[model samples]
Target: MFQESGVMNSEVVGKRRKAELVFQFRSSLYFVTGNLSVNKDMTEENTLV
Candidate 1:
């Protein structure tokens, strides 16, 4: 029973870590895209001027 529980705990931990990594990756991608959009808008405005 103890060994089973230990294995389960490690599985849970691995799943949690993967979820966290994916979340971080998604957030960073969003941030990069947001910055790119902002910069693109600025460039467009400058061209118009």
Candidate 2:
């Protein structure tokens, strides 16, 4: 029973870690994309002028 509980705890920890990594990755992607979009807009406006 103790071994089973330990395994369960480890599994939960692993899942949480995976979720945190995914969240961080997604947030980074969002910011990078936002920056790129803004940059593109600026470049386009400059070209138009």
Candidate 3:
């Protein structure tokens, strides 16, 4: 019983870590795209001025 529970706990931990990594990667990707768009807007405004 103890061994079974330990195995289950490890599986859960591994899944949680994988989920955390995916979330971090997605958020960083979003942030990079957002910054790129903002920079483009700034350049357009400067050109207009």
Candidate 4:
């Protein structure tokens, strides 16, 4: 029983870690795209001027 519980705990931890990593990756991707759009807008304004 003890060994079974330990395995289950590790599984839970692994899933949680995976979820956190996915969340971090998505947020970073969003940030990068946001920055790119902002930079594009700034360049367009500069060209207009």
Off by more than 4 A, model 3: none
Clashing pairs in 1: none
Q: Against the hidden reference, what TM-scores do the models get?
A: 0.92, 0.88, 0.90, 0.97
Model 1 lDDT per residue over 1-49, tens place: 9999999999999999999999999999999999999999999999999
* CA shift of 36, model 2, Å: 0.6
lDDT computed for candidate 1: 1.00
The lDDT for every candidate, in the order shown, is: 1.00, 1.00, 1.00, 1.00
The 10 consecutive residues of candidate 4 with the worst lDDT sum are 1-10
Question: Per-residue lDDT tens digits of candidate 4, residues 1-49?
Answer: 9999999999999999999999999999999999999999999999999
How accurate locally is residue 46 in candidate 4, as Cα lDDT from 0 to 100?
100
What local lDDT does model 2 show for residue 6? 100
Arrange candidates by TM-score, descending.
4, 1, 3, 2
* Candidate 2 structure, TM-score to reference: 0.88
Clashing residue pairs found in predicted model 3: none
Worst 10 residues of 1 by lDDT: 1-10
1-49 in candidate 2: lDDT tens per residue?
9999999999999999999999999999999999999999999999999
lDDT of 3 by residue, 1-49 (tens): 9999999999999999999999999999999999999999999999999
